[model samples]
Target: MANDPTHQFLVNKIVPIEIGGIDFSFTNASLFMVASAAVASGFLYLTTSQRGIIPSRMQSVSEMSYEFIASMLREGAGSSGMKFFPMVFSLFMFILTANLLGMMPYFFTVTSQIIVTFALALFVIGTVVLYGFYKHGFGFLKLFVPHGVPGALLPLVVTIEIISFLSRPISLSVRLFANMLAGHITLKVFAGFVASLGALGALGVGGAILPLIMTVALTGLEFLVAFLQAYVFAVLTCMYLNDAIHPGSH
Candidate 1:
């Protein structure tokens, strides 16, 4: 029987060890999460261990990363965005690390899972809602109704806006999950070709050679995608935060 390449991304309980009816054993997914964090921490620590007036290469990279996120917040969320800089910075770093680490062979890609992405989306949406209410009280209700809509159209417009607002988490999670899942599956299918056809097949083997080359190219592309997806995720979060902080503003 052949393994279903599409379903290969599904999570499995590797240990399945139960304690008093509760599964407490660490999973491959959990392992990857810790590994991703450790790798990110180690890399940054090693690179930035030496702080100098002139700035070492590692320190330069760290400074550059900080500037990049700070600039993004300033542009997307404005100057007041600085107040939430720590939250935004941590989010970007964790996501960027998880994504980049997942590119390694045999490493689990947690972000490729809908559950993981959904959790992230839910957190972002929840933060926006909580903060909006905290900052503006019931006035945040104004967010659902645009300022210039006619009284007759206000109800309908508010209804639609509410629905769209509720769907943000779903859309955000699905976008990331679908992209990662599709890319990884395509890579796996092409890899299967190289293994199954490249040895004993006819010119099919030569055809497989092209896919082999493509696999290498696609691997590099996936790395870029990992970073890009993280950035997209962060940017969207900033946009949502902006909307929450200043509802009805252009």
Candidate 2:
């Protein structure tokens, strides 16, 4: 057990089982991902199963979430983009649940791992690219060409647009993963400081108290970061989708 606290990144095979030489073994990260999916599914299922006229608490929360995302899509992507509501909604719910789940003790924060976040970001960016092509045919290539640029500068401008568009997944995935990883690492380090110093008498105890206070404050901020990161991911997805739908001016 490394005292560094970030040793949690190591994926140990809990079952230690393999099939067809493939590493399909269960690990802490895998378990957390399953838990996240189950929790999200269970929450939405229960919330929508019973629709009361006045609405139950869970139902109200669910409805509010739907409306909230719908409003965001409407504003960011416009009414035409409402077609993507379900995808956006699902993305938000999945990320939000995963984030909050990671905050629980002993639960693995899969999003802290670049592999998980990169997979998600790839899926989203891939979908946008595929849909852009499907919607516009070859004309989607026009996205790389900004309007109002002089013919002489078109190549340079197009190259820049292409690079920017191609970098979407890298930037998007990194933002979330980096935030979760850094925040958790900070919390762990502060906690270690408190533990190590509190062992010393009197003066050390007093010093430990400050780190404890900072730890609590950091925890609250982490919670907010979790939500904000999820929102940022979904919003960026919407913005990219919007660009695909209407790749007009620069």
Consecutive 10-residue window with the lowest summed lDDT within model 1: 1-10
TM-score of each: 0.91, 0.94
Off by over 4 Å in 1: 1-3, 6-20
Give a tens-digit lDDT track for model 1, residues 49-71. 77677888778987888888899
**Any residue pairs clashing in model 1, and if so which?**
none
lDDT of 1 at 37: 76
Candidate 2 lowest-lDDT run of ten: 1-10
- What lDDT is obtained when candidate 2 is compared to the true structure? 0.87
Q: How many residue pairs clash in each candidate?
A: 0, 0
TM-score, cand. 2 vs. native = 0.94
Native-to-model Cα distance after best TM-score fit, residue 124 in candidate 1, in Å? 0.8
Q: Which stretches of candidate 2 lie over 4 Å from their true place?
A: none
lDDT (C-alpha) at residue 38 in model 2: 95
